[model samples]
Target: MTRACATLTLFLGLPQGTMGFASSFSACRSQASAAPRTALLRAWGRTSSGSSSERQPLRHLRRRRSEGLVASLSTKGEREGNPATEEEAQLLQHLSSPPKSQRRHQQQPQQPRTSTKRGTTRKRLTSTGGLKSLPIVTPSIELLSHASRRSKKVSQDMLIKNARNRSRKWVAERMDMLGKATSKPLRDIIRQYKHQLPILHPFEATLADLTVRAREKTGERTLQSVLDDVNDFRKVALEISKSAAREGKLGEKKSEIMQTMDAGYSRMEDHFLTNGSVLEDLTEIQKSLRSLPIVQLHLPTVVLVGAPNVGKSSIVRAVSTGTPEVNSYPFTTRGMALGHMFHPETNARYQIMDTPGVLSRPDGERNEMEALTLASMQHLPTAVIFVMDLSGHSGHLSSLDNQMQVRHELRRRFPRRPWLDVVSKADLPRLELEKAKEALPEGYLDLSTLDGTGVEELKTRLFEMYEIIERILAPPPEVQR
Candidate 1:
């Protein structure tokens, strides 16, 4: 009876169904084995009452006995039997929690994280708990791979979108910059200049707007956009130049106008050189820097050829800034003189040479003035500028025979050269002007140089005349616009 009470007291200390195993394990030595078996059968409700699924709780213990998965319980049960068995039996009750490592990690000797990822082999437990190396999930690599794929996909999408946006912006800017009117063709000689100008039309217009108007109404802020667009204007100009030059029509005003710029001369030079076109003609135009003394070949050079004291030097001094040897005598100018005049609009310049005096007399060497003027044109055979005095009626003129001789010599020597005519001293009486006009060549200009009366007008007319003469003398092979 005292033994039964002791066994009952121990049974009270254990968990529910575990009390059956506890009693059986302890009571075999302490009391009745049959009593423990009866208690186990009662705790189970009945020995036959447990279902197959309900009987599954003991399956782990049965399986663990074979696999030795319960080492902690096995060792502890052999040493301090009852309670250790009870604790292990309770441990097997739930799967959510795992047993602590039996080796106690040796406190790991405070191992650094540098320990190998491969775990130390587990030891059989000497205590009531054990650890199994669970599958080590590499959270970092999985996460990194996923994130990398997602980020790469996102980056690719962004790059494509950005490129599309830039293309759209570029198209918008290009269209806006090259408005409508400037894109049209230029027509007429007195009208628009048809040549593609050196300055890019867009940029040139923008710069021009910036200077004249304090603010641009185009609604753009960055100068970079403006500059970017203007660069192409020079390209258009180069195209025109190349086309014109290829056809040998580069000198025609309507054709050459395509290569000029309203911006300035330097701008044209920049646009021309940007595309690497050879500027041989420009070198000839700005010939001041030329090392060799240049001669204009077979060019019509009309000199101020007249008798001294008839105001021949006056005409040279009046039209250009030439300071001739002026005196109130017949033999004042001992030698020939040279001067030049320039006009911007038609792009004309004249090299006027003043002479002594000319006469109708048929001497072998001729008059001092007539001799020098004719001699220069006779050899080079351009044109002659006769500065005849138109102040008196029935003027002392070069005879038809003498005129015929000069024309014959020029036609024989330089057949392709051009000639220009001039009737000087227009401020004279109208009667003398009309009489002088009858005595001169077909397309003659009357000039009074002192007052700049016909100076600029004459320059435009002369330059226009030069164009006609230039076209007639040197027709272009190409029909470039």
Candidate 2:
């Protein structure tokens, strides 16, 4: 076919020579004149089929986009040294695909292509977040124990030296010997037991009670009482030793002198233990007390109470100056933990104490840990913070059951105590929003320790509670009598 006829046939998508040659040529010339001109893209010595010419417009449109994309990609690839970036692959895909309408019209079934998500590596979530440490009471249990043991050893050493070097010395020398032997060790024992009264503030005392297992022999004899007994024994021993030395039997009754000192030591040791033997319970109490957080009773206190694994510790760690151990399983916090919240804006400091989980169990059946919770609430002038975990992740009981049981117990037992109910784990999907609301106390808060939801509101409410308490406790303005 002639070039003009061929061009006209291709443009019309018709059979060759369907029209007369002169007519075809005229049609081609008319079409060429009417068609908007485009720059001709040179073929790179590649053979072209008739369909290629038919697809020329689409190819030209894609060519411009492809060239620009590839040039940018080439520069980036040279710098990065990686081939076929995600953007390049996506752009090329769009460029290569036919129009949506055309694809829809096609009858061919497309194979479903699998695509991998980029940057989807799973993140490792820690069971607990780091938190600030509280100014805890550390009595140096190891050092104290070591010193106590060493003092006894030194006293025994002195006794042995006195026995070995029995000088028939004067009354003054013998009295000095007995006094040094008795007083030094007695003083050490007294020092070990005696604590500054101020250090054991009401909260600290309660913490000692909750954390330490003090052995009560006749009912009310405390650590202070034991130390007082030791002090009295020291005075008695000194008197006896001086009297014996003055009577001129100091050297003659060496065994008696040793026995007198031994009796005083035995008395002091017996008060700490049952059989004047190993001070097991007292030692354990000391260890526990030393580890306890030194909570100040002066600040406004808030105590958290809830079922185990109800995010109590999590909230404390997030908002306070304490970092209690947090785990998915229940009862991670076995003892009372202390923390403090300092509000910079209001300049209000609130002491936060997280008590061990209190279960919905019988009073008699309740263990020591649960008893500690009750003791703290009953004794401390605290604003109660009870967390309701609607997520049902809290151990042993359903959210509704926990709320109902805790409410019943608190109302029946501590009706007059002021408390705030907070719903924890608010970031989790809440399937029981209405149910939880109905079950929860009035003015309940939804809080998330993870995302810090409703924390500020909680702090504000706590401050408000403090202010109200302050007003109530404040002496009424002087009556104009």
Candidate 3:
């Protein structure tokens, strides 16, 4: 019986002391007769050592079983030997802890910062002259683009797939969405422009005021009036939305709540459309404002002013960054154009303005283009470069007549301010030049834009005048031992 159990254990690849195999053998002994046991033994012995063909099948079966057991054991051993899982656990723990740099930052003292205004807010930056503050110009497209992005954000963040049909929370959510949709665009436009307008330099503010007042609308509406309308309408729409939501909650109708939301949104859109003229005007104003040159008090400005067809723009193109249209017609420049010139060595930059042609006619005859030039000359700290066409070929105004007109209004008005009288189109005719030279102040330049005559001397003279002004305006140096 012991031998039979051992043989069974050997065949199954178990130790001889294994009770499981012994029990199985005992059970087989009880169930089967002695003849069956003897038959099994005979089968085993024959299978072990017969002909080569007979032994081959049993050998292959045993090898396959041994190989499978070895493969299973090796797989288990590899799994036990691997350190990847342990390393991952350690790495995860390390990441979960706060970094040393963060901890050190937390221990450091934080300084409180104050808001700094762009340019000066006070009336005068220095005692000598009152310079207007510079305001950052915001484009209309910028405001509209911001509004679009904000609306898209609100839609994405507030999506509702399932809501309790007409519950209080759902109704509230709908109202919130409605309010956001209605108020965002309108409020954004008005609020931003309103805020920007107030803090601007007086010159800019006046310009803005003039621009806003110029547009023909249904009713007279200033920037403040537009803002008031938007604010009032917003409040009304939000209230209406809230009332609608309340009614929806009382009755179990999500449709009713949504209808109210739509109504509110429509009202908001209507409010914007009703002020459509204002928006159109504002967009036009933005273009003009963007074109308006930033006036810097510290830097010198050379303004070229003349009647139309007089080469004011040509001289500007020659001397500065401005490229004004030069042609043989009146009012060639519809608006003022600006250019920049930087002095070498000191690297100091200044502005050169090419103003729209101002006719020698009366004030009532002047247009908006002329008004813009007049405003700059009256307000901005600048020197005048009165350009005259030496050629009387255009027949609008003779060189002598043009020079006399400039001297009458501009020169008489700002006598203290430095002036540069330039006769352009020098290549045209010596006849007009000789006639114009009689009325010209000393050092008046004869310049031709096409031939590049007298442009360098003009630039040198401009810079020299700028330096002289800077020297005079510059505060006295402290007395040193």
Go through the candidates in order and give the C-alpha RMSD of each one to the true structure.
54.9, 43.6, 39.4
- Estimate TM-scores for all models: 0.29, 0.47, 0.54
lDDT of candidate 1 over 23-69, digit per residue (tens): 11100001101123233223322232222121111111111122211
Query: Cα RMSD for candidate 2?
Result: 43.6
Query: By TM-score, how accurate is candidate 3?
Result: 0.54
Instruction: Arrange candidates, best TM-score first.
Output: 3, 2, 1
* Candidate 3 global Cα RMSD: 39.4
Local accuracy of candidate 2 as per-residue lDDT tens digits, 310-366: 888777887775454321111124545576776667666667778777778776576
- Compared with the true structure, what per-residue lDDT tens digits does model 3 show for residues 1-481? 2222222111111111111110111000011011222232232221112111111111111111112101111123322432222322222222232455554443221211111134323221111111122223233233323332333333212344445352445545555655565556656765554344333433443344344334322233333333343355555545545665565555556554444444433333333333323334434434544444445555667778877777776777788844443222111235555677878668787778887777777665665566666655654556688877766764565446755785678766555556788878888866665665567778888888788889889989889767744443343332233
Task: List where candidate 2 sits over 4 angstroms from the true fold.
Answer: 1-291, 321-337, 397-399, 431-438, 472-481
TM-score of 1: 0.29
Candidate 1, residue 335: the lDDT equals: 50
User: Which residue window of length 10 is worst by lDDT in model 1?
Assistant: 20-29
Give all candidates' CA lDDT scores: 0.32, 0.44, 0.47
Rank list by lDDT: 3, 2, 1
* Candidate that would win on lDDT: 3
Candidate 1 vs candidate 3, lDDT winner: 3
